[model samples]
Target: MSSSDLAAVVVTVCVVVALVALIAVLTQAFALMREFRRKLEDFDSKVGPALSQLADTAEMAQAEIGRLRDLLNIAQKVAGLAESAGAATARVAATPVDKVRSAISVLRGAQTGGTGQRGKAEEEGRETGSGGESTAAGSESRGR
Candidate 1:
């Protein structure tokens, strides 16, 4: 063949080889992209429900925390009221009952005979003897 024709043939063959290589590389890249997209879809299908369930559980926990916070507030209010009431009771109880109880005990002691009734007859006899002396003196004067 002529040198010019041989050169043209070599150029055409080079262009054809480059085109085949480009096609092959593009096909491999397309396959890799397709596989990546398929794995992404599969992950979405498999993991989406679990992520949704996790969100639901978090919401439930938040609601429960709010309820517990409300309960704590109520308990704190009750505790405060009880503390005030207890303080008022302590103040009111600190006085007169003790005085009245001591007074009552003193009165009872007098009634029960301070030394347990041992001096009752002696004390009574002293009062009766003094009266009897006056009467006897008056009777002797009247009789004379």
Candidate 2:
């Protein structure tokens, strides 16, 4: 063929090859995008529930922490009240007969502050002691 005809044929072949390459690249890009979309959908199907469960766990933990904070606040108040009570008992124990009514008032006031067990134990101790032999004898007679 003539040189000009050869040049035209070469240019045509190059253009066709470039077009084929462009089509191949576009096909690969589309396939990769489809695979990525499928993977994201699969992850959503599995991970969505897991993330929700984690959120619930975090919410429960937060609730428990709030309860613990309230418990600590109650504990601090009880400790303060107990300290005041110890001071009152100390003063009462040091004084004489006139403080008996005040000591009864202290016990009655302490009864409402969640010291029922301690109060009952103290009552039992008092009943069993030699300091109140007449009340113990009365209880023994009642049990018969």
Candidate 3:
């Protein structure tokens, strides 16, 4: 064969080899892409429900927090009412207690003859040298 023809044939063989390698590489790339698409679909099918469930859980937690807050508000109001009731009870009780104490003091003063001086019986007892015990014994002997 001629030298120019031989060089042309060699170039043509190398081009054919390169084309075959490119085809093989393209085929492998297409297969890899198909596997990647299938795995992505599987991941979506598995993770989609989990994502939805997570969203539902978050909503439920928010609802529970709101409920707890409402309960706390009610408890605070109840505590305030209880404190008010306690103060009212104290005020209501104090007036009656003070009135009763004053009435008892007035009764005591009446029994004591309503004067700063001693009663007549106490004055007579002090005028006599003996205490009122001797007078009570003499009265008891007379009753027997």
Candidate 4:
């Protein structure tokens, strides 16, 4: 064939091939768009409710935390009151015991012929005796 005719045939083949490639590219693009639309629909159906539920749970958690804070404040106040009550009770208990000890000291003084030295000596001896007994017991246990 002539060179001009051969050139025309080559141009036609090239145009047809280019058209096929463009059609393939357009078909793939349309398919990808459809797939994206379907995924968006699924996300709306599933994740939308889940997000709303998560928001509700978050709100409830915040409310619960606020309630716990109030409860903690009340507990702290109660603990302070309990500590003060314990201190008051200790003072009250110590007062009577102190009075009894003073009365005992006075009685001991009378019994010991009003000699403060004798009363103090006797009290010391009693404390030493008790301490000695405990020490002896501890030694015996250790020996065993």
Whose TM-score is greatest here?
4
lDDT of each: 0.82, 0.82, 0.84, 0.84
Q: On residues 28-134, what C-alpha lDDT tens digit does candidate 4 reach at each position?
A: 99999999999999989999999999999999999999999999999999999999999999999999999999999997667556344544554676687855655
Q: After superposition, how far is residue 34 of candidate 1 from its true place, in Å?
A: 2.0
Tens digits of per-residue lDDT for model 2, 1-144 = 999999999999999999999999999999999999999999999999999999999999999999999999999999999999999998887686557878878866765543555445557868778436645554554444
lDDT value, residue 4 of candidate 2: 100
**lDDT per residue (tens digit) for residues 84-119 in model 3:** 999999999999999999999997767555332334
Which residue pairs collide, candidate 2? none
Off by over 4 Å in 4: 114-144
Each candidate structure's TM-score, on Cα atoms with residue i matched to residue i, is 0.60, 0.60, 0.62, 0.72
lDDT of 1 at 67: 100
Q: Compared to the true structure, candidate 2 yields what TM-score? A: 0.60
- Model 2 lDDT-worst window of ten: 111-120
Summed over model 3, clashes come to 0
Candidate 3 clashing pairs?
Answer: none
